[model samples]
Target: MGSKHVFVVAVIYSLCAVAVASNPCVSTCAGRPTGDYQSRNGCNVYATCVNGYICDNRPCVAGTVWDDTLKRCEMTSTTCPPNPCVTSCNGLVSGDYQSCNGCNVYVTCNAGHLIDNRPCPSTLVWDDSLRACARTSSTCS
Candidate 1:
């Protein structure tokens, strides 16, 4: 291959390496206090960071996924959203809305800002249509 073609291929290869080798905790836990933190890579995975170092990566209990809002593992039978908590409240009217993270959690928004993330009562799930915590029937999945 010509020199120019070689350079372009090398640059593209480097970019691909960077894209595939990212660790979600590297950005999420940096400068944060020592504690368990959720990993954006997967719902069942979490990480423990201590003094800017990822000391451990752990999995949630079977049948559960890490709940970033609640800071704990929560049960879920359905497939998790690909990119949870990526939904923005900006430009949205103030109201209770289903969280992008899990079905059992909801977010409170005010004037286009996210105020809080709250979990539905145990054994219940947030009902987006009703905008309330209701008994989980078939929709929680």
Candidate 2:
């Protein structure tokens, strides 16, 4: 019985120590705002600035404009362009934009449309319904 109690106590202590060591920062600390100096509590807690204002060195300041669409802050009197999908129409077929590549811009076929010139077996015909070149009939080849 004594050994069992000692083992249980050791297990509880180990669990508590692991929990404490995993998360060392408190939830009430604030992060420093961009273009502002770092505050003492900036690195401690996870607080943020209120709407229409930004946290500067753990303090809130006015005149900090926020781009609600972008979910980021910007300087005053800054103008952002409209949505890319609306303006550029690149990669848009009918009304949809393609997924982004690493650095190259390209268009993606929307529903019911297929990419042209893909390799297909001579016996099979390109089927837009299947999104791949498939045999028109099983007897084709």
Which pairs of residues collide in candidate 1? none
Error of 2 at 134 (Å): 1.2
Candidate 2, which segments miss by more than 4 Å at Cα? 1-116, 137-141
Q: After superposition, which runs of candidate 1 have C-alpha atoms over 4 Å from their true positions?
A: 1-86, 137-140
lDDT of 1 by residue, 31-87 (tens): 788887655335566667788788544887866766555667788422333223315
TM per candidate comes to 0.36, 0.18
Using TM-score as the measure, the top candidate is 1
